[model samples]
Target chain A: MKFLVFLEHHGDALEKGGLGALGKAAALGEAVGVVLGEGASALAPGAGAFGASKVFASEDPALAPPLPQPRVDALAALVVQESPDAVLFGASVLSADVAAGLAARLEAGLNWDLTDLEVRDGELVGKRPALGDTVMVDVGWTDAPRLALVRSGALDPVESGGGAEVESFEFETSDFSTLATLVEQTQEESTGPSIEDADVIVAGGRGLGAPDKFTLLEELANALGGAVAATRAVVDAGWYPYATQVGQTGKTVSPKLYIAAGISGAIQHKVGMQGSGTIVAINKDPNAPIFDFCDLGVVGDLHEIVPKLTELVRAQRGS
Target chain B: MKIAVCVKQVPDATVHKKIDPATKRLDRFGEAALNPTDLNAVEEALRIKEAAGGEVVLVSLGPEKAVESLRKALAMGADRAVLVADEGAAGSDLLGTSRALAGALERVEADLVLFGQASSDGDGAVLWAAVADRLRRPLISQAASLEVGDGTITGKRQTEHGYDVISAPLPAVVAVSDAINEPRYPSLKGIMGAKTKPQETISLGDVGVDAGAAGEAGAKTTVLELGPPPSRGDSVKIEDDGSAAQKILDYVVERRLL
Candidate 1:
């Protein structure tokens, strides 16, 4: 089967989720990738190493700043021209729009909230989480060019060291499609890597005693070259920004190493970070629900334990 | 500007959900309430109405029970409410739901349409875009803040790194994020006044949408199987003496991660 994956970028580099989608598509069958925006041409080659055999790029100036309508037009044009059996997307604020618009434009089927995709008996099946992530359901489309939107961080990216044949695609948009204009993009100023790109995450919860005490998690994260995250409880308490919140209602993260300090592992929070490779939870309450799922659980006062841990990591890193 | 806010009646998130074994779908017969995020959309619409001096209309699609959500929106100061309820509208996916809503929205004259980013129950977060596509209007989603002036709508959309400032022409679809504003509680006087507000209940035929083109029959995706999530198994607990942190470091080191 032929598959086309939409690649998302920050106008500088391709995003991990899009690369992950490409990786999955490559595993299934023949895969192609498409990049859109002003700097899209530069990102085409990167997908080749990850799994795509052919990369299509549309670099109109109007496609800059990551707006969706122009991208929908660009992608719809590609779909009509290429007519791939399936189109895959990684969940993001922008790609979701493009995927939805493309689905409506083509009158095609879009199965979203998917965690995995596979082909069985010559039919494509998508797996999705339902009933608040408590269960997994198998979903299939009634027709093709099947559209699937995978959850963020659902797939791990693997590089194949293969080169891609680059091609350029063009799209014509109406005045209504170009009505939305992106004025400026301002990133939140932070010292370390953002949570999405971080391999290691040190997250805090209400057990931290107070908001200012987040410095403890930050110190350890800085020493370990990781990022800091927080539970919805602390974020809702005005202790942290919603961007760093990890839970059902917040952003889902699947880091290489995740350490939960002073967090009680509620199901809402667990659903978000359960995909982490290694989970180490520190809480004074031994019976905390988080202990049921974590790989290693430490029972103690986070205030004393976290500071000591930070010092040790700092000494080990010699920073 | 005349505004239309899309509200949905969803099972309360606080309630434990049950799945129908046969259909593999969530059982909505339990206690249902207005989606919390839609309350924010309603609040945004009311604010836009207060600022631009226009009427706020609420639209919903579901079973007859969905009217409860519309009434709550009316109580919150929406000038009017429209309920599109049909027996065949059950099990409609995001696309079908958007189609039904677009049909209802066409009946009213709206300069702007607003929706919550996502419903707590579905969490798909793509309905507004579909509605916009069906209506062939501009869409701006995940708006953290919004402004209107000179026949245009502008908003700041939150992103992983930061936020993007985007502007679109009027008569666009806007989905507000939870951070936009705090929803207001309906006053007693407002609740009483809402009872007198104009409300109309229409069926799929009334909106010119065929029953076969929506709800379960028109669903683009079908569920093949439903099962509990994979278990993580049991975990190991460690008593934190003074060396607890060292053990963690050793664990990380053992895995060659550090």
Candidate 2:
């Protein structure tokens, strides 16, 4: 089986999720990497270590700003040429657009929210979560060049210690494709590591009491040298930024150690952080479902418990 | 100007959700409500209609019950609604839904189309782009703000990096994010007025989509298995004694996590 994986990158470095897709695809079969952006061609060699046998790069000034239209045009052109059995993508804002556009352009089927992939009887199958992730459904594509969009942070990138050949493609985009212009791009300023990259994460839920109480989580996360995340309840309540939300509807994370404070451990929140190596729940409600799945359960008030925990961790660090 | 908004009926997440052991599908038993984010799309469309002097129409493709969601949109002040109810659409994936919805939009002759960034259930966030692609129209997704004018539709899309201000022509597709605007609740007068509003039902065939190309037969992907995720393993419960924090710290230290 042959697969094509889209490598999302900013400048010369590729996103870790894309590398994960490449790694998965390479494990299944021959995996080719497709990179589209301003300096897309320069990213081919790095794609090799991630298991890409060959890299297809499309570098056009018009494709700058990483908008989806030009990317659709570019990927559509490449897919028509390569005709791989399946196309896979790692989740991101731009990847979502390009994947949808490609599926529409090719008149092919796109299956999304997938967490795993496998080849069965010479056909590709994807695994996705349904019913608030209470069930994991096996999904398969009905057509060739089947498209699959994996959820972000679902796969881990592995190095094969191999090299890949790089190929550059030049294509013409339709005038209509270039209609949308990206005015500007700003990065949200963050203090510590992002949830996606943080090895340790401290997440809070409505149990945090108020937005101001989030400081307790912040202090605890800081003392542990980890990032802070929030449940959908707090994010929906505007107690925290949407970026820090961890749930079925928010970002999926798999930190080595996840500390959920004041979270009820709803299924929605559980699905997002279930992949953590060790889960610690601190909630006053002993009946919170989070305790059922957590590695450690602490029945207590977060406001009282979190500060004490932070002080202890700080003291231990100083020791 | 004419605008069409796509809406979906999803099981409210606040309630208990179940999956059928036999079929391995989300049991459609229980309260079904309009997708919350789609309410933002309806509100955004209504605002555009109020500003641009146009009609807002609602389109949905699902079981007959999905019309309940369309009716809710009508109650929110959409001029009309179209329901594409067919058994053939039962197991359709995002692509099939897009094809069916795009066909319905073509019949409505929509100048602009809108959808929520993603449904709370599927959370795919890729449907509108597929629809826009099928219709050969430009797409602006995850819009935080939107405006329609002089044969062009512009929107601001939120990204992890920041935001992107994007503009497309009048015949474009836009997906609004929850950040776009606060969705308005249906007022008493609007709910009563919605009772008399026009609602039409169309089939997949009526919209030029073949039944064989949708639902289970036409689904690009099929579900092979359904089961709960793995357990998180044995948990070490900690009682809230005065020394609970010290115990946690000790555990953290033992794990070398600090």
Candidate 3:
């Protein structure tokens, strides 16, 4: 069976999530990776190491634009021409955008937020959390080019692998139609670390007592060279910026060490962070759901516990 | 420059919404709301217009009552609004919705366009791409933060392994992440102004989108079934006390839950 993987790009190579997603598509069949930008070949070894047989570069001037239509058309057109058994797109925000458009264009079944995937007995099966982690759904599709947007951070990039050989396949665009016009593009400067990609996240909530308490977390984040994440409550109270929220409606994180202070682990929030390698929860509520999912549970005031822990970690570095 | 923001009214996240056992799908009446994420799009568009100086038009495709969402957008300081209403559009799958949006976009000369990264309900980010494809423009998705320059737009995109800093050309369709900005409420003057604002409430018919291709009938992948996620088996309440820990340990060993 042949499969197509869509790659999202940052510059000349793959966007982290798109690269990871192409890694995912490699699991389905003899992989045919499709790229839309220049220097995409630099990103091919990762896909190849994951099992892609070849790469198809669209080489469109507009491929690198962080826009949806051009990316969608490039992938959709390639999928249509390739007639692969299934297609995979990164679950990142941009990948989600392309998957939605491609899924619609291909009229293929779509399963979102997939965490694990495989090709079993000629069917593509994906596992995703459902009902707040109470249930796990295993969805499968037999149709050709069955489209899926695998969740960002769901699968780890293969750690021990060499770049795969690159043999260019054809990227065709004859059947594609461009509907939207590009008027202008602008990119914003980042202030804090992107929440979804932070390694060590220090998240605060209403339990922080008052807005001022976030100061310590900020200091800790600065010391650790990390980002400060917030609960919806903090943002609602105007104590923190909404951009720093970490939850279902917010950013989902898979950091190595996630420290939740003063925040009651709402189920939605838990779903977003439960995947962290080691979760440390500090809430006065001993029965908080967050504790149930944590590697270490500290039943105490965050204002008191966090400062001490922050000092401990920082002092460990002797900085 | 005129910009269009594709918006949606969704169940508020905080609201307790449960799908009815009978229909096994979204219970809209469960808790009505304007999708919080879309508000980011509305806010971003208004901010752009405020900064760069342009008109912002909000568009939505849903039930007639969805005019409330458009009105809310107006209250949020949108310069204009459009509601593509038709029962036929109710169940429009992603493609149908995209086709509908594409038809409307063709008629509207928007210099820039935006959408919520994904609607909280459908949680699908299609409109930006479909519209972009139909319009033949570059599309940027998941714009966590956006800055517009004299001739280019740049921002960081969340990716699988890390964030990507990307640049795109003008007239791009962007899906704004909720992190972009908080939405503003309609000011007293803005409320009064919205009343005077020219909002052309067009139906699906006006857009020339084939009703057959706009909703359930037009949808490609139909939901044959919708149900709650499979439930986890009963949990053995593991007592954590040192004495009870033995039982928990025994249970863990017996089950190999580790």
Candidate 4:
């Protein structure tokens, strides 16, 4: 099967999720990579290590901005030229828009938030979690050039030794596609690793008591060399930035250790972090559903326990 | 400035949602409510109408029961509502659903279209782009803050790294994030008035959609099987005393996580 994976990149660094999708596609069958933006061609060779057999690079000025419409036009043009059997993407804010627009533009079938993809009887099937991750549903496309958006961090990128053939492609952007202009872009000031990349995640919930209480999680996360996350309730309550939200609507993360403090272990929050290697729940409510799934459940007041835990971790690290 | 707000009826957040093994579909017979984020879309549209001096109309596609959810939005100060309810459109996927909704928007000739970033159920968060593509209009998604200007709309959306501010002309599609605004509760007076507001129901044909091109027949994807999620193994529970912190640290050390 010939699969085309959309490799999302910022400058020369390809997003890890896209690389993971590329690696999986390459493992399944012939995988080609499509890169768009100002220096897309420069990033093509790098995809080779991630299992891309060939790369199509587009350096159209219109596609330079991180907007979805222009990238959709470019991908649609490439789809017509290549006509690959399927197109894959690692779900992200920008990639989701591009995939959806491309699906609409090409009138192709699109499956989203998929956790896995496999071949069955020579047909591609997508595995998706539904109903708050209570069940896994097998999904299949009814047409060719099937489009899919894999959940972020669902697949891991593996470096396979090889070089890929890089080819430059040309595409046209419709006038309406360029109508939206980017006025400003700013990065949030943060330290340590992002939740997606952290090995340990210290997540706070309404149990944190207040917005400022998140600093306790920060201290714990810092002691453990981890990142801080928040439950949807706290984020929606404006106790934390939306970027740190961990739930159905926010980003899914799988870390080595997930420390949920004051979290009730709701189904929504569980779906996002259930994949963690070890889950530790610290809440005053012994009956919090999170304890049912957590590897280690602690019934206590987090405000006191978190600070004490941070001290122990720091002492253990001898820092 | 006529605005069209697309909304959905989802299983209540507290509900333990399940899929019927026979039909492989979400059993929607339980209690349901308007998707929480969609309320944000309705609220945003109402705000725009209050400022721009035009009507805010809600549009939805679902079983006939969905009108109850629409009424809730109507009670929030929307002028009217249109629901596309037909057996033929029962299992419509993103494409088919967008086609039907786009047709309704076309009929409305809305100056702006709004949607929640995604439904809590499907959570694909891409339907707005599809509708916008079908309408051949620009789309600005994940809008945390939106401003309707003379002929353009400026939306600020939070991104992974930070946020981006984007501008698109009128007659655009926008999907607002939950961070945008607080949805207002329907007052008793508004709830009573909503019953008199026009609530129209149409079919796939009325929206110029071929019946064969909607619902399950029009869906481009299908479910092959269903199973429970992988289980996490045995867990150990402990009551926190003075030593709870030390026990956790020991567990971490035992696993060599440190």
Candidate 5:
């Protein structure tokens, strides 16, 4: 089976999720990378290391911004041109829009929030977690040119020590596609590695008592050379930025160490971090659902214990 | 400035959802509530209607029972509601659902279309985009804040790295995030008046969608199997007697995490 993987990039680096999807697609069958935007061709050649045997690039100026419609138009044209068996994306704010729009444009089927994909009996099957991540369901498409959006961080990009042949394609954007304009874009001011890339994550939930209490998690994260994350409740409450949210509607992380402070361990949050190497929970409620799954559960007031733990970690790390 | 808000009735978030063993689909017989974020969209539309001289019409696609959810939204001050209910539309995936919704929106002919970022049940978060594409309109998603001006609307939305401010013309689609605004509770008077409000339920054929092109028949994806998630293994619990920090540190050290 032939697969086309959408590779989203910022400046020069390709998004990890897209690269991971490309890697998996290459492992399964012939994988081609699709790159768009001003510098898309520059990023196309690098797709080889991540397992794409060939890269198709469209450097249309209209596709430079992170808008979805233009990319959808370009991708739709490519689908009609190449007719790949499937189109895959590593889920993101932008890629989700593009994938869904492409699906609508092509009148094709899309399976989203997928955690895994494999070929069984000559058919591509997707594994999706549903019902609050308590159940896993196997999903498949009934027709060709299947579209799928894999969950963020669900796959890791692998280096195959190969090179890809780069090809350029041309496409037209519909008038409606150009109707929306990006006025401005600004990054959140943050220090340390991002949650997705952090080795350790110190996550705070409503149990932190107040928004100001998040400083405790931040300090702990800083001491451990990690990053701080928050539950959807806190983020929705404006206690933290949406970018740091870790849950069903947010980015998924698989850090080496995940410390849940004052979190009740809702399934929404559990699915995002369940892949961590070591899971620890600090909560006052002994009956908190987090205790049922965490590798180590500490029943205590996080306000009291988090500070002490931060000090010990600071002393041990000697930072 | 006529605005149409798309809403959904999702299984209650507090309830432990289960998939039916026979159908491999979520059992919807349990308690249900209007999707939380869709309320945000409704609230935004109401605010826009209050400021501008226009009507707020609700558009939904679900079983007939979903009228309950529409009534709740109507009590929040929407003018009227239209629900495309048909057995042929059941078990519809994102694409199939978007087809029917796009058709309904076209029939509504509102200047502005609104939707929540995603439904808590499927959590696909991309239906608005699909609908927008099907309707051939501009789309903006994850809007944290919105400003309507002459023939145009600007939205501020959060992204993984930062935030973006996007602008699109009228006759476009926008999906608001939970951060957009707090939804208002139905007033006593509004609740009483909601019963008299106009609610029309139609079928897929009414929206010009063929029976074969909707629901399970039009769905391009199929569920092959269902089972429980993998276990996380055993856990060790300890009560804090002023020594919890020390124990946690020891566990971290054993794993060399620090």
Candidate 6:
């Protein structure tokens, strides 16, 4: 019944999805947090607060940002030493690579991209949209170590009771191969707030003429205490970083409240964000594709609506 | 450079899928094919071979049916193909899968190993990196654009922030992305040529690997349960009337969506 969690981090602090994954680890017997790379201890208290019984870290300095395959190898080695019944990973790209790699190292099947999950018959049955959302796939590994990749925002991460015991296990050493060396890393500080943890997300699309016009989107995002997202076009134009792009080629986000402005919803975009708890779209084009998928569709100019809404929100918040 | 591309068969991404009541998962009933990404890797390997004059060996460890993908690789111009078929290898998890593939690769002398970012079904995208680890080689992943000249290689690696140029020495492992190149269709002559080509198959013992370490015991992740997809919601039918635009706008206001 043991559940092991892979805790993702942003420079020593736990990531939102990692918190979500930590919450998921609660159901699996004794929870262990497997962290990769340097400065995994800053996450120790956060991991304990989130619900890990023990945190295991690989403090390898050669590990690069984003590509966590080396960490996967370390986790696999850990699984060999401590055979947990289940492993859970956040559905972010870096975590997914680590999860899949660790799962391969363990010869386990993965229930991936799950928006919903439940334990039935002593098994974790995971569900995800498949085939353009045309069909649902329930993925579970019967004979292998139970592995689940839960999407961010799919589960609410609350205080997991005890700021539990933080036991640090020495990384069972192995001669690491193909050390994923980071030749370069470009990090753009997000404007408003971190979107993965944002309860509300304000998204823009090609309708916003220039990258600076994204300031208005940021204004709306600031008013809502949310993060600003952009479509594939915005990211392609290099107006926004790829992390802020919510679409097929970009990050798949499932925020609770999503407000899309001046955006056209392509199926690829819809696939990424349709899981939002609530969706509202604003665009001047009556037939803009976003209207089809959003819970609330506004056929108007975002330039007009966004500014007015920002004012309303600011007034409501007494900011 | 001796390059090996590990490919897997996947259900075409665009195929219509149905949920299997028995499995409670997306029922890809009968229409699984080689992962579209593998073809991209195959094409990339062909391009690399065309430029560098190295042999491209396509290797996959799956059931006997996996040869279909190997044939496609050969059709795509891979110089050779290998299928490692064993029942114990069946239902191999990511680690065991990578281990088995790595074992097979040990038998072949190669300078580079290539793989797609990931297979569509597992989408875990772990094999190439894991195999690279198992092979004890330098690894680079998510390369969207690649150029090989002399003893040096350069590729643009995709990241959530943006792409960064990666340089690696020879005898490196790389996983290519679908954006790298379009896989070409196998001409009739290529198809005919693949039939006459040779493919080597090896065993778990011969490759010098542990059997228990592979298959289920090697896996660390597991699927907990299967659930059907969320029910499709009521469609917001846009009325064809030209003036319905105003109604949509009003609906937008009522929801406080502005």
* DockQ of all predictions against the true structure, Cα-based: 0.67, 0.64, 0.14, 0.75, 0.75, 0.29
Tens digits of per-residue lDDT for model 1, A104-190: 877788888787899999999998877656788899988878998988777867889999999997889856788888888887777
In candidate 2, how many Å is residue A82 off? 1.6
lDDT of 1: 0.86
Supply candidate 6's per-residue lDDT for B180: 78
- Which of the predicted structures, 3 or 5, would earn the higher lDDT when compared with the native? 5
lDDT of candidate model 2 versus the reference = 0.84
Question: Candidate 1 chain B: worst 10 consecutive residues by lDDT?
Answer: B227-236
| Candidate 2 residue runs with Cα over 4 Å from true position | A209-216, A222-225, A236-239, A307-319, B12-16, B20-25, B252-258
lDDT of candidate 6 at residue B159, scale 0 to 100? 61
How would you class the docking of model 5?
medium
lDDT of 2 by residue, B1-258 (tens): 898999988887676777676765667767888888899999999999899889999998877877776778899899999999998888787777888999999999999899985777664888887888788788888888887769998888776555678888779989888877888989899998897898888899999999887887776766677767765567788779877788787777787777
TM-score of chain A of 1: 0.92
- Candidates 2 and 3, the one with greater TM-score: 2
lDDT of 5: 0.90
DockQ of 4: 0.75
By DockQ thresholds, what CAPRI class is model 2? medium
Q: Write the per-residue lDDT of candidate 6 for residues B102-197, one digit (tens) a residue.
A: 888887767778888556564555567567656766667788888785766777777654576676776778888666777899988999999888
CAPRI accuracy category, model 4: medium
* Model 3 error, position A200 (Å): 8.1
Which structure among the candidates has the greatest TM-score? 4
Positional deviation of B46 in candidate 3, in angstroms? 3.6
* Residue A84 of model 2, lDDT score: 93
Displacement of residue A253 (Cα, Å) in model 4 is 1.9
Error of 6 at A201 (Å): 2.1
For model 4, the stretches where C-alpha displacement exceeds 4 angstroms are A311-319, B253-258
